[model samples]
Target: MVGAGALIGLAVEFHALGWSSIPGNSCGGRYRPCPEGTTPTLILAFVFTFAGFTGLTVALAAFRRIRPGKALPGALAAAGVLIALWPGWQAHLWLRGPVLDPAWQASPDRPASVRGVGVWALGDGAGTVVRARTDALIAYDSATGDRGWVLRAPARESVCAMSERPVDGIGLVAFARDEEPCDTVWGVEVSSGRTVWERDFAGRTLLYGGGGVLSADGGVAVALGERSVHGYGLTDGAVRWTAKPTAARAEGGDDAECEPVTASSAGGTTRVVVTCGRYTDFHSAWLLTLDDATGKEPSRRELPVESWVNAAAVLSAEPFTLLVQEKDERGLAAVLAYAEPDDPERRPVTIPLTADEEDLALTGLHPVFTARPVFRAQVADGNLIVAAARPGSDDAERVAAYSLDDGRRRWHADLGTPVVALAPAGPGRVAVLGESQRLWTLTTGEGTRVGEEDGTTVRDIAFKIDDGPQLVRAGDGWVIVNADGDTYAPALAVRP
Candidate 1:
């Protein structure tokens, strides 16, 4: 029986460690069933725990058959061993130590006169690039903190918004100016500090309103006054096409009151989704899809109007366009998947927060979304991971994972900080940046403290550079962008 219990314990440990097998299982019975790859691990854990319990029963039966004096000592010893091993089993299944290498030193000569808004680790994670808001546009080397090149804007209007991503072997920098009648479009080469092309639209008002710069397949799109949306060629910034609004404006209504909320490009097309309202409180929203090649309006769909429509990340290409909208109530987030025009299917999922949860904000850089209380919640891999600090306490934060499909709580762990940033690293792992300047690499079921560095206060952090939770990578290390325009990359204690 003792041997059987030991074997069961070993099996449970293996399964819990992601080694054993189960079948078509959904975690905690939320969402859909688990993927086929997860079945083996689940079965192994169940069998091992059941076997251990059976062995305990058999050992108790043997104790009953023995004399009272001998039976008492034997039972006590078995119970003591079991008690000691149980917590150890849990510890082995969860806790991992901080991992770090001390040989690496911080890089010098970080970019000056800049504030990092976004960080991108490009090409095999060897080259780390950061987009900072300076008097000009600059890309800094993540490893050595060397400034690569700086491209100055045509006119000295503050960079109201900027988006940076690698496109066609060059870092594309898109900026919009709050000032009018000037060139708002600029592209800079990261390898060589040169402006490849610049275009000025005299009458076009590039909305500084929130949303992505509509660019894809080497092209850029911008909404002019309420009447038209224009697409430009990437090579020389030539106008490709201009799309007009589908609905005519009502007379006597103020035209300037209407504005676009978000614009996105995908599948060789650029789309402008706008929310407009009058001062009297009547509001309407529309989704307008434009062809990048011709700049013609292909389809337009009117959507239900909310007080505000927060743009979530783009999901998949087929079936529908998935977006999350936060309602006015605290702690409520809605996921809406809309089919293209002429398709009849719509999937809307409303995810409610825990009763005690509050102050949730989604990270802009990473694919995952986060909500904060004293405890925080992250959405990834079709699951929600919630981390909550204990009541009236601030030392350690406890985390719980739930399957997004079925809303089942999977597992929980304690992380040692108040999380300020939560970004997705890979499938089930998350890179958590804390207000304490500590970085923790965490998975749905596991976590470890990886490294720490001094960080500026929350108020000093700038959101203009797109360098928040979405940009940092836990597998490589925590990249710090200081207030003085210096970007620092420190090696994380945990490896990929």
Candidate 2:
């Protein structure tokens, strides 16, 4: 009886994981195909099912040979009867087709003819904010929404690029201006809106992920390209360090490239982690740590990665770890965390997601999970926030927050939509962006949605993928960007 119960429980768990050997539906939904092949759930399910069948067959044979009775035959007959009628009584409800919300019309008060804007809430005591556009870098007073200063870049270069976004620190903002042949990164003063320094790079500059592009101590800003990682001084914008993956160059051949995942500098050490290889072939990731003062490599650690892992990023730099999101062979979406690049212990902690929860998350949202990997991991209120679905029927999806230190679940919010983004709002509060154009205020302490709002809508099918308004923290309030890369301060009033 115990063994049977265990087998049944295992089956139920595998079903909850949403893994299948059904070819294209390994993630097991009608929405989209997962990039992976077979899943661990399917493997375990086959084991359990085969074991149960063997046990039953042996039991029946023993009973027939030793003490043949009607009991064994009657039991088999009853099981067959139940199995035959099980599907007849079951009912399934198909969901409604997703409807497109109205395209967000920017307010007239917003900057007109805006090509692109990078909004940063310079939350220092001065209550100053910065916005970078194609032609100008404008600073604003957060108190009255008054424009402060505008420093325009030279006409030979553009202020923003289609791929890279600007990032801000205490009183400085860093951005990459795409020139004719190469891109240059400029660090400007937020108060005066003056260019402090500029450094040229071989390719596009790196944008900040969960851990911002700047180091923790604000000494160096890290930029990543297809083949190399360039570190620049935060104050002077001088090239501090340049690292190319030795393993990738040695093993990946001419076609393989080194992709820098994430970087952080603390306690006079700057660590940059990069994954090297061709996605269609085998690859590995390595962590490179250097002395910030001299740009010397003191330690290098090779990270263990699955052959299927195509992308990774640093969640928090204090411990210096990487987060990976990919589908397994059976197509089940998986989120995993690895130790610091220097550590050899590569066992990853798998973040859990349920089939029902995934359904809620993908509803009204684009089904391209593999295209957006960094969105899978977030850090809010010192806790790591992961968008995972729990096993349930009523679409009770949750944004689970785990401890940054121990990976223990700290809190979770049962928002109906999948959490697409998490931004720090205020003390103990987080701004959760649902897959749909909805924003909810979640208190990290209790995992409760204390505030909610219908955010910007999208009418065009093209707008449904990739480009969405980003949520930013301005002092104690919020700032949002729309699909057109225009900044709107009106959404700042969102509060629980």
What lDDT is obtained when candidate 2 is compared to the true structure?
A: 0.49
The clash numbers for all candidates, in the given order, read 24, 6
- Model 2 per-residue lDDT tens digits across residues 61-167: 66678767866655664464355333312310011111222222223224455444445556453365455555666666655556678777676455432112234
State each model's CA lDDT, in order.
0.45, 0.49
lDDT of 1 by residue, 1-496 (tens): 4555564555556565543222222231212222222455455557767876787677667766774455564556455546545654554433322322221223332344433333344555535454445345555555555566666654545443333344554444444444443235555555665667665543334322222443445455343433445566665567776655544447855553444444556667665666566444546566667676887776766655455444443333232333445334452253334434423243233333332432223332222111100113456655565544554554324555545454445555554545555656666676665543334557655443333222211211222112233334423554443322344332111222
- Name the runs in model 1 displaced over 4 angstroms: 1-97, 101-114, 170-183, 202-211, 218-227, 246-258, 277-281, 297-300, 308-344, 352-359, 363-380, 383-416, 436-438, 444-471, 482-496
Worst 10 residues of 1 by lDDT: 366-375
